[model samples]
Target: MMRRRLLYWITALGLGTLILASTGYAQTLSQQVLNLLARTNTWTADQTFDNLTITGVCTGCGGAGGGTVTSVAMTVAPAAIFDIGGTPIVGAGTLALSLDTQANNLAFMGPNGGGPSVPA
Candidate 1:
């Protein structure tokens, strides 16, 4: 009974909020958050990536179109070090990314340490 009441209240609140949305209001925050990939900015630099670990969802064949079944997987890897020209690009940075692919603003990049020495 309590669960039903809570659901009822939630539904009602959602409906009320939707109805009360003013015409003057623009895009919703939830819509923007869902559009992260759409909003990603493309970045390109002489990025020497090391100690890199990328995190993102991967979809496999399944669901309505039947195929091999499997669970969600999490992958990890160790960091590395390398050089780009005279500038030693060490640690993970956004060099692999192209400014066209990533649609986000090119914000400030943190200093990952660059010297003549590239750590082994």
Candidate 2:
């Protein structure tokens, strides 16, 4: 009986470890998006700057008398938002932004080899 109990405990521990180990391979949607962005460099960071001025300080940059100060304002594009557990639903090779795995179990509802359509 003692040996059987030990075997049961070992089996339980092994199963628990296996379950936890399997989860490590599965990445969250946000993590996947971040990894993709880092690799692809497709998105640009958002930035805002105002009243920026530069003055010469180097020996060859010339003295303050010869330097000029300029004011400028700039804005950069914002990054894309990655919704949690978000998955794309494509139909006829077109993405249906309005459809998701949660809302629609089957994302592809059109006939196979059908013509392309505009993505949502």
Question: In terms of TM-score, which candidate is strongest?
Answer: 1
Clashes of each: 12, 0
lDDT values for all models: 0.27, 0.28
TM-score of each: 0.13, 0.12
- 7-118, model 1: which lDDT tens digit per residue? 1111001111111122323232343332332243432222122321112211221357656533332222321222222222344333331123333574536466744667
* Candidate 1 segments exceeding 4 Å error: 1-69, 79-110, 116-120
State the RMSD for candidate 2: 28.9
Clash pairs of candidate 2?
none
lDDT score of residue 13 within candidate 1 = 16
